[model samples]
Target: MTWTIRPPRAEDHDMLAEIYLSVRRQTFVWVDPGKFHHEDFAAHTNGETILVCEHADGRLAGFLSLWPEDDFIHMLYIRPEFQGLGAGTALLQALPEWPQHKYRLKCLVNNRRAKAFYLSHGFVVTGNGASPEGDYEELSFCPV
Candidate 1:
């Protein structure tokens, strides 16, 4: 099976938006349900690398958004049907190739699946951090 990773085009909005919305709702249950949308994706995706994995059959399997400064993985999501595939692993292995200084990100306290994913990828807990817009706490991860 082949997957394509390329710069996004305007037509990719719907697929990207769907993935963002899924992760946003699942990860940010405390936030507004509508936090993920086309405009939000368009705006945040600017000046960042958002990679989408298109399956051999042309399905939008998953995506990852990387912010080089804080090494923020603003989001990562795979369609429910596509979970457990190499899509997530492929997306993550593609990160170090990106230009970045400090590699850091936060995972929800209750999202063990996500935390485990980061852990397996060599991310370890450094300390605690909060969701800037809310009271939720996150177990911070750093690659060092």
Candidate 2:
């Protein structure tokens, strides 16, 4: 399915938060499973450059939040139904500065699927760190 990737607007706030929370509930089942707060997701996305993915039918498919100045990807959440459909790649490619920026992200050690996706998209495992739930692998990708 084709998807349009674009910068987020104020009206997309609630939808973005919902997507964030939903994807979290689906992907991070090991982290406080079955619990998600939109308020917390909203706060976490504040001040980040967020881009939303819209399906051809106009439904919001996914979103990615990035801190451009820091070259970090804070979140990249695609609806469970939309996974493996290229929305994640589209969102990552939509990063403002392209290959010029050295982008980094963290994937929980238990999220093997996410780690594989990141690696397949050119991200490399750089390090690891402990978190309240467990250990997370730090990954970085230089777009070029």
Q: What lDDT score belongs to each candidate, Candidate 1 first?
A: 0.70, 0.86
Taking the tens digit of each residue's C-alpha lDDT, what string does model 2 give over 23-142? 787877887855578886778887988889999998888999888788889888888888999999999888876667789998899999989999998899999999875799999997
lDDT, candidate 1, at 63? 87
State the lDDT of candidate 1 residue by residue for 71-143, as single tens digits: 7777777777777777877777667653232456667666668778877766777666556445323434543
TM-score of 1: 0.76
Q: Candidate 2: list runs displaced more than 4 Å.
A: none
Whole-model alpha-carbon lDDT for candidate 2: 0.86
> What lDDT score is found at residue 80 in candidate 1?
71
Estimate TM-scores for all models.
0.76, 0.92
